[model samples]
Target: MIVWSVLIALAGAFCMALGSALQERDAVRAPGHSVARVGFLVHLARRPRWVIGTAGAGAGVALHLVALSGAPLTIIQPIGVTGLLFAIVLSALFNRTRVRAGQIAAGTAVMAGLSGLLLLFPHSAEVPQLSIGTGLGLTGAILALGCAVFAAAHWVRPGPRVLLLATVGGAALGTTSALARVVAANAAADWTAVFTWLTPMCLAAAVLGGLFQQNAYRTGHFAAAYATLLVVDPVVGAGIGALLLGEGLPTTPLNQVLAVGAALLALGGTVVLALARNRNPEALRAVADRDEPTATKPGNASPGARASTTTTSGESR
Candidate 1:
């Protein structure tokens, strides 16, 4: 069962990575002006690449749920770190460029850190019977955090703003995963019970998480935003598992210290990837051009220029 769980999780990671890479192109290409407008999704929905990417994302979500059903959150969620490596590689390939040494090193560091944590500490988790009150409390907490993040994003610099959004978005996404396990298990026994239970909350959180994440992609560096998301998402998942699902992980003094160190190491890789990507800006250039800090004034650029800048390579593969 562990073997099957691990394999399924790995496969899900690859699918998510592929979908993320494809969606990065769309995120940047989405209009900066009308983001808050209702038509934003409608516009993206019409794109061929976005549709294909959505398919990959949907499939990945399904695979991840299966993996979660069989494995512990600590074991399953961390496998998603591979998605960052996949996104970077795929992004480079799409741009017709070679991967940078810095990218390689950063990816290596992320894998190493995640590997160390998983090996050093054994984690076990099972979906528990959460009360309605307890579940509502968890939902409220995540929503409060998201609200704070959303407010902070408007006041900060673009770089930090993107990071904030990405972090909160990851947390929201991780909560969705935690709640999903609950919804699924309960749904198995009483089909309609979960509908009014965690299901609606999970879906709502996923939408907001995805929205913030996509916005971060447009506002932040591609590698930076995605790396933050990949590293943070599982940490959030692990935390949610403990808090919401009653899956307590290691909390000894030594374990606590180690967890912090491991998290920092994984996070440090984002910086390395960002630095490595500085040299080959073309990979993110298509999207970054529109997101650049003071690169071009919207007023100065002609309508045609805006259109050209937003024109994604539209690589659908």
Candidate 2:
């Protein structure tokens, strides 16, 4: 049962990753807020592709829910990081995105380290729980901090927006995942856990993280955003679970070494993603060009096929 649950959670994470990838493609050509929303609506309305992506995400979530029911939060969260690897492969195949061998190697290191570290956490029969007051206070603080950082990042030149959104989204996803781990563990707890401040905060973080990544996809390279988010989310979640939740470590020194190694694996993967992004700046544009949009102006062959036109009264237009 525990294994099954883990599989489900992983499936959900995988779906979510794919969805993020698809949304990011759409964001590239969207230009502005209104355009982006309209683009999304149009994409979803007519394209069967988005539906497929959504279905994958839904399946992954369902699996995750079952997995959480059986395993410790600490254990499950690290394993969930596999979705990053899956996303890399899927994006490469479906989106025609470029990836470097170094990125893949680095990501492997990080995941390996994380897996080792997670093994150190003590499994408890007790499920996780959320406290309304604590959750609200913590969530409010994090959101405020993230928003401040986001604004500051936007204030700077353009390139960093990808990094900024990646950072914020990582934090948001980390918080939400950490909270979710707690909630999953506390499934057997009382009803009060359901109404706690963590509930709303988790929901909000999930939404914000989705939006942040969406925006990241629009204005920046996918590898950059995906790599940063992938690397940071599990790391942050594990760190919080260890420090705040009193999760422990492996007793043996060798295991500790393995844990560090796993962390390096995850980091390596992230580097691979980053380098890939740098090497192929136009990767995002390529994906965007392929994804069909919902609404087309009359007499258009496709969004990418439009040729520049001039009226008789040309005025530098």
Candidate 3:
């Protein structure tokens, strides 16, 4: 079962990478704020690439669900880091450009740090349950916090905006994943758990996270945005897992230091990769154009970064 779980999780990882690449391609081409509104979903309904991307993501999620049924979160969660590796490949292929050694080193650093973090988390056989009322309260709090971040994102610069949204989205992803494990674990023992606030909360978080990722993708650095997700999602999950579930943290000094060191290493890689040459230039221009509308406002100014437009294939990412 462990082997099978690992295999299934790997498949999910690949599918996730494929979906994001495809989605990012279309997302970059999309008019600013279009996908954020209700109308663009209706617009997206007819686009084949976007649809395919959605399908790929859905399939990956489905596979993930299956994988979790057999594997512990500790094992399966780290497997998600592989998605970044896959995305790196997809980005190079689509751009018809060879990847730089630096990018590969950066990606390796991220995966290594992620693996170390996962190794530090403690696993337990226990499954914690929240009363429907408690679950609802927690869900509300999470939503309020995430929405606050989302709102704050609009008032900030692009880099901060991306980070805030990614963090919010990652928080949602973590909570949703933790809740899912709880829900699934208790489904047989308590049928009532299947019909509670957890279900709705999980769905809502998943949707919100997906929306955040979509918007983040519009920034044109597929690897950059994804690297953030890879870091934040599991850190959040580990936190929630420790507090809400029976999951444990590094108790030993050595484990704690190692985890922090690994995290810093990953962060260092992400910082270096952000400046990679392969990122689409049109995205910068699009962002600059968006900020233009707010430039004249007292505190709201145009993007500080100068943009260069580089046209790629019909797939703009």
Top TM-score model: 3
Candidate scoring better on lDDT of 2 and 3: 3
Residue 247 alpha-carbon offset, candidate 1, angstroms: 1.0
Candidate with the larger TM-score of 1 and 2: 1
The superposed Cα distance between candidate 2 and the true structure at residue 174, in angstroms, equals 2.1
lDDT of 3: 0.73
Candidate lDDT values, in order: 0.68, 0.60, 0.73
Ranking by lDDT: 3, 1, 2
TM-scores for all candidates: the values are: 0.76, 0.67, 0.81
Model 1 deviation from the true structure expressed as Cα RMSD, one decimal place: 5.5
For model 3, residues 140-229, the per-residue Cα lDDT tens digits are 877898777666666664444555666677777877777787898899788887887789988887777777777667666678778878
Off-target runs (Cα >4 Å) in candidate 1 are 1-11, 34-39, 61-80, 116-126, 275-317
Clashes, model 1: 0
- Winner of 2 and 3 under TM-score: 3
lDDT of 2 by residue, 180-249 (tens): 7787666545656556567778988887676666656655456657767766776677666766666645
Q: What CA root-mean-square deviation does each model show from the true structure?
A: 5.5, 8.1, 5.1
